[model samples]
Target: MSTAALITLVRSGGNQLRRRVLLSSRLLQDDRQVTSTCNSSTSEPRCSRFDPDGSGRPATWDSFGIWDNRIDEPILLPPSIKYGKPIPKISLENVGCASQIGKRKENEDRFDFAQLTDEVLYFAVYDGHGGPAAADFCHTHMEKCITDLLPKEKNLETVLTLAFLAIDKAFSSHARLSADATLLTSGTTATVALLRDGIELVVASVGDSRAILCRKGKPMKLTIDHTPERKDEKERIKKCGGFVAWNSLGQPHVNGRLAMTRSIGDLDLKTSGVIAEPETKRIKLHHADDSFLVLTTDGINFMVNSQEICDFVNQCHDPNEAAHAVTEQAIQYGTEDNSTAVVVPFGAWGKYKNSEINFSFSRSFTSSGRWA
Candidate 1:
């Protein structure tokens, strides 16, 4: 494989692109029918999405940083084998996602979901560091590994833990077979959400990417970001004979290399407490007033707070549009990293298609209204 092929490998298809469009603009009824018209008969439903193609440049994307040496010389790669299939079925009851390559030449973000059964659904987001390989690998293989190990487990947390470590070990085996030491360096953060019975949500996360729950329009955090700057993380790194400090970029990193202490494939940093163990959380959904859930990488979280993000999502009835709103807001706020957002709505929020609603986001933390 060459660099161009590698780029295509990771950047090509969304398999779930249709689901994003469907859920981002329409609402699923109790009877399994979807409607975008909501309760209004006068106005047309907003179905347009914010897709970044070769079109007009977004003002937020700085013009100076979009090229790289890989454009001319495509590096040769070893023969590749197809990864596990994307979840055979989609549980598009109420889920949405949006991602932007931002100023980078290649996008390292990947997200998808699978409906294991009628009542069980799995969602994931992977943010790659160093390159898109690790992210793509996790996005393609993590859930498959999870489902394969599902029947043997009784505890959700234990299952999630096993799945993550299993992926780490599989990647290690692949690296050895391919003789690709680079795989050990290219790592990604994994954030997976499991929705059982449509009301019970279990999230497993490693690294800075987060999952936030919006209950009655309030932001409730579900996962803790695994950054080296955190006190416990810093102490743990020290215990492992590693140091944490701000690099020239003004960001914290362990051993001046990897920033997040926990990830899927950063094998080089694993000795320094950079393990793949994921933190898990369970959330019970309330149908009357409880709203959607938002999962995003640090790109969005760095620019927007949980409260403001929840407020923005509350304004968009469609989860995809909600995700787009979050990412667009992050870019507008000048978040330079590649941004991605996943919105999963339930209960009243699943059908709150108030078409006339529009919202503006705040660049800084003030309070939580739609008036930034």
Candidate 2:
């Protein structure tokens, strides 16, 4: 994008960025290091599938391969209740991730899902926009930043908010350190999903990487895209002294540079109304139909709609391979960008319909029901 560098978070309510600058220069595409770091998955409430290349080639620095693997699971969540009766203990069934670099010179995407404690499950996706540095930084440090500020009393939503803002602040500090520190304009979108106390679901997001909740074969969108074209995001940017303009083909960009309005880096875009404040959404697992949760980047969602994803998951032979199915489909359908997906199934095969399922986003949470 346009590298017109002068920007600030505080606006004077004046037209500091002229409209003429939009046409001054063509948007330059930075040929970044195809970093394995998924740029980012950003949003207050947030939370991928896939391989693009058909070679079954292994992951490499330049190109090719699938990095699909299962994460730690079977951690027990505290017991809950159903219909005023105490429910039995709950544990994870499975968690899996898959990714493909597609046509890019190098893959700049990264993903991970881990069981933080007996009761908390953490998953993340990073879709880097400008370069790999921001995504790498997030993949490496986002959780640490969040956990360092979190209190023991359990304010999950507030912790999410602080965690996102912390990354922005930390990145800014790093950028100011030296001219050679990092790309001041590099940024990534990040999505983080938390399943806590076995039942509560909290999604915090910024940027485009999306999360979906599947229930009885139906798809429920769990995050909002932070692209500049969205009405609410446009207004938020304008209020912060940033202006949205259409590039040559009518795609929206903030200050004629960045495509997304919210992220963890792109320090130059901060003053233009782009921010890292994620909008969070909370859900309590109360449906027996709440089959599983799918996390993916734009590489998958950009090519397929919500229903298609639902149907794909519903037909999976194994929840462990759900991510592979999603990413593999994304490539077959034509996704030129990096693709990644994470799947978290509720219970075991043939046992889901007969399992206990109760979860809430609030302080007081409970759930216990047959899986099927």
Candidate 3:
């Protein structure tokens, strides 16, 4: 009786040990599989941020120092503390901006970038015509208007549209208060971008200022010019008693005045369908493919097309360098308007850089004056 009881206890203990061994083996095997996947050359590349170490350092998007020497603005903090995960640091130091007066007596192009909320960032460019008043007002007030609306509105597109319309109304009121009645004619093309959670990109634009995204060495335009050349825009203008007339260069203008069918602070042409309503586009960013986002006024756009700009920026080492290169190139290409460019780096900032060089010996069509 004693021998049989002892044997039964031993057998039970053996079974428990076997079960523990099997479970440990399975756990170890799962870990090995993950390691293999991360290290495998055939498998998709892995981001170093997710490959954690015990160092406890926060993830960062760029190591580049502060871009501007004049303004000592703070760099953006990582979202890890708020999001409960290691989100990349989106720093203003990594962003680039450049502006030139070009042939204009005074630069009417304005651009800015800022951290709007914990999870959102703002970038914008404004091209003013008739005067710099509209661009100046937008550059100063656009971010504040969007920030004020964010607590009440979650949809960025709606916030941008409302902000634009509100700014237009406010500008009209401000103009009415001024002794100068001609402020009503001051108008600007506004292009604004909001980047949320380092992925969601929403852009709102009125007139011809553009926002372009570069993904995998390719350019994806985020805005369409609000010109009378577009059949839909032309029809809308006509319905509002506005007529489209072309200049000597075949560039169409609304009511033979404003070049764009939509803009901010064009109170004098309000009845002629030059509205302040913005067209918005939202995109989910893929960090592995998306390199950067660039916002430009027509000065750069008219002289250097999107692809050319993308290639030009791709050759640069950092966002700040890229911004200067694009705008400088525009001036070199003979743009007579005030030129401005802002470059914001993304996850693939240095990943998809262009190794091949490009050359442009031919003068720009505008400079050559061969409108044919």
Candidate 4:
């Protein structure tokens, strides 16, 4: 296979292979410390400790390894569906697997949502690259920033822009800790979506995480990936005194450090103009065509596309089941990163709202029939 193909395979398939190797090796041998060297000489600050010859102990788990353990913990989400006209029914799921790389556990991803009022639904997905701090921060603060921007009229575009800026400011301020403070080098890609009046959807994003809308049997992309090697992204990086380099794997990375143009909380790279503010977009929801929304990190994109996921969801009767299947597929295909997904069905709002109409009991739907 070509170098590019090999790199893609390693990224997509390496996690599971690595996990099996690690587990089997541990079972056969009592030592848990497995040392491996990266192909690149210029290592990311976060992964440096994992480098065999680096200053840190040879066996110390790197960010990726640390993340593997973190993924075993259950995902936490804020309260949602408080009060909304035609309240939306939400379903989300996440899973972690070690598929390809035998060395470190690097991928981290999360999603959270909150219903601030009767007309607005705020949600966000964070895909961590170097570590989990950035994604975790986004998951915690996304709702607050978005809700702060919501006006009486509910303009998603304006709110998204303001929210992105606010998040950047918040991250910058947090990064300015004293030199003696202990800090972990971490960052994450983020995407935020807001649904208003049950029709308008607004999305804002930075880095490689994505948001997709399934409308009229067609999948539409709502956010752009700010990859380092993309022409526009390259230009922006070069303008900011940074250079993109091709690693032994032939993948584009910023100064052999990062792979994206925008992200949240890479304190080390912030000086190179890697801002956390997201690019924003707005779209009107269509009832006749719109079916569901899929939000995920780069793990899903490594093996499949939006259409593939949409088709999988089409086969399922329940959104939650669809989410489980998608995560399973990502694992089977070899996504090295911690795979996380949030699936939201479009038409479930009507049923959810109807339940609220009758206060005596809460109604739910099953594959066979509706239940009261």
Candidate 5:
């Protein structure tokens, strides 16, 4: 058989299997509904099949306990196919971002989020150092580079990897065209994520920027910092004939310059083991347990831990408020750096309410409201 024909046949079989699983879930839900109905009187309303409490009302999208009544948004496709019930769509309208200059002379952080394709959503955070040129370039071309590779690559992981390398090469060409030697030194931390079919999440990151997920009121870090502080990263740098040195603040730097082992630019440091290659991760999202994806630059990450950020978000009404709250709080805590945060609500957003969170302003912040 031809390759295209075989690919079509495989997809057809996958669809059939999905349909079978969905049908089974529906049958199970129908049986529960019947039992719940039979157990109650005609005047009493039936509770939701997924409802933890026996509330006497039919389950709406709100039954997931994710959304606020103010939004009243309806569920989109894909996710419903699996649950045999409605789950609210993860929309661009629900994505939120906040960026602040803080004590920096220039705000060097950049972030973007949007629907990249019909089935994929894109989100990224770039923390620029030395200059904003690299971050700015990435902010403009990263999405396009990823979309260009999506048609050729079936796996999202490969797509992200190729996109990162492509964008890094593109930045080098751009820097050369600008005729600015300083642009070569400009580098940025890139943490990019793609959500496909509302089920698969793929994240690729370099440098110290991070992508974190909130699942069932807890924090799950999706990316790790690619810094000389990591033993493997340090060893890799040493193998490349590079050395690690500590700054006055005791932060390790590769070759006594760049703090990270990987980045998007910094052409001068490329030979010293500061590479553009990113560490990538892919995960299957569980809508019922996964609440949102939060992307942050080291500015906020250095000041606020992932659990603290997650709890703060859980206390907010929506993604927009959550993003602003986290960045603002980082500044309030005396971070002398640019602070930026992007919050993308998933199927389980707002499921954990304010009452569920035990956050204290004094607990995370120091007595002088400074970074401790």
Candidate 6:
């Protein structure tokens, strides 16, 4: 068979198998969109858009189209924190899944913390490659990593460096204890940011996942994807027993299995010297910057650019709405993988705050409202 034909067959089979798994998993909610069709003869439910164009054969059955069954439900906003100075309102929405097998269904893609006192907002997105374990691990531990590094008299640069190193160490330790190869095999890309004192923002990342800062109606990428096809990445991969291959798009990949040069976990791949160290960057937050931060997996990036997402978000006043819109757009564009997003608006702090406070005093008061 021709290479194209072979590839199509493989994809079709994979899709069919995935559809069966999703239907049987029973994890999807009825509200979620699922593709379906009616059989001409039996009048029963069949595959919708599951057939390839002009193939006259079922391309494959896939539930939720190219998206994943796992979705990130937004955390309820506290009334007190919903409208306050420095962090008026923050919201998050995520959808998508990892490429098949060896990890949790959904990769951890968003994390945010709004602190009114410090006027600091922390947000992050992790894009897992091999599995969800590494991504989820980062999601749960990132806050701890930052807190540990920040309170120790370290500068933002130093703190970000140490935090990423610590994250890798933590993942390695956990994987070792589990004695499960899968844990070690799973890896993820991560990008994080901290909006500090409403004056500056710090960002850091590793792997292909991206972080973009939309400022003044323009998108500025904060992190670089450490793909193995780059000159430096190729040199490193070569030294580590891996070779880069050029795809039809002329993009390079490591052993055609992975793309990024650095990532968290992937113990087996790390043996060749592909460490899990992250590259970090920082920027100042400005008043003229009607900016927002967007962090997402490659799945979303595959179909839409950072500027495109930012433009869409800019149209919507609410971050939650913006996130949903971006996800929907990704689905419409035919991203055949899990899609997730987190949109954080800049310069909109102070809208979410508590209107009342309760206090008590032990001393008795006179009729004149004087304490006695």
TM-score of each: 0.70, 0.70, 0.78, 0.64, 0.81, 0.63
Off by over 4 Å in 1: 1-93, 350-372
Q: Which scores greater on lDDT, model 2 or model 3?
A: 3
Q: Each candidate: RMSD to true structure?
A: 17.3, 25.8, 13.0, 27.1, 7.8, 25.8
| Residue range 1-372, candidate 2, lDDT tens digits | 011221111111122132123212211111122222345434311111112342323222111011111222222212322122111123335666888997787777888776666567778999887778888888888777666655453867777888889887887887788585447888888899887765678999989999998765667899989888788889989998989889987899899888888988989888888889998999876423466788899889877677777667666656667788888777766677799988876522222332232222221111111211
TM-score of 5: 0.81
Better structure of 2 and 6 per TM-score = 2
- Cα lDDT of model 3 by residue, 166-251, tens digit: 99999999998999877889999999999887667999999999999998889999999999999999999999998999998898
Clash count, candidate 5 = 0
Give all candidates' CA lDDT scores.
0.69, 0.65, 0.78, 0.60, 0.80, 0.59
Residue range 82-120, candidate 4, lDDT tens digits = 121121223223211111221236546777766866567
Error of 2 at 343 (Å): 0.7
lDDT of 2: 0.65
Point out the worst 10-residue segment of candidate 4 by lDDT. 75-84
lDDT of 3 at 314: 86
lDDT computed for candidate 1: 0.69
**Model 4 clash number:** 17
Candidate 6 per-residue lDDT, tens place, 1-372, comes to 234423332233233355345444432321122332332544434333333242434322121111121221111123212222111122223211222111236534544453423434567777776767888898788787787666674367677778888889999999999967789778888777776554457887888777887766677898888987568877988887877777886887777767778888887777665777778888865433445677776767776777677676666646666677777666555554566777766542112222342211231122112332
- Comparing 1 and 4 on lDDT, the stronger one: 1
Q: In order, how many clashes per candidate?
A: 0, 54, 0, 17, 0, 13
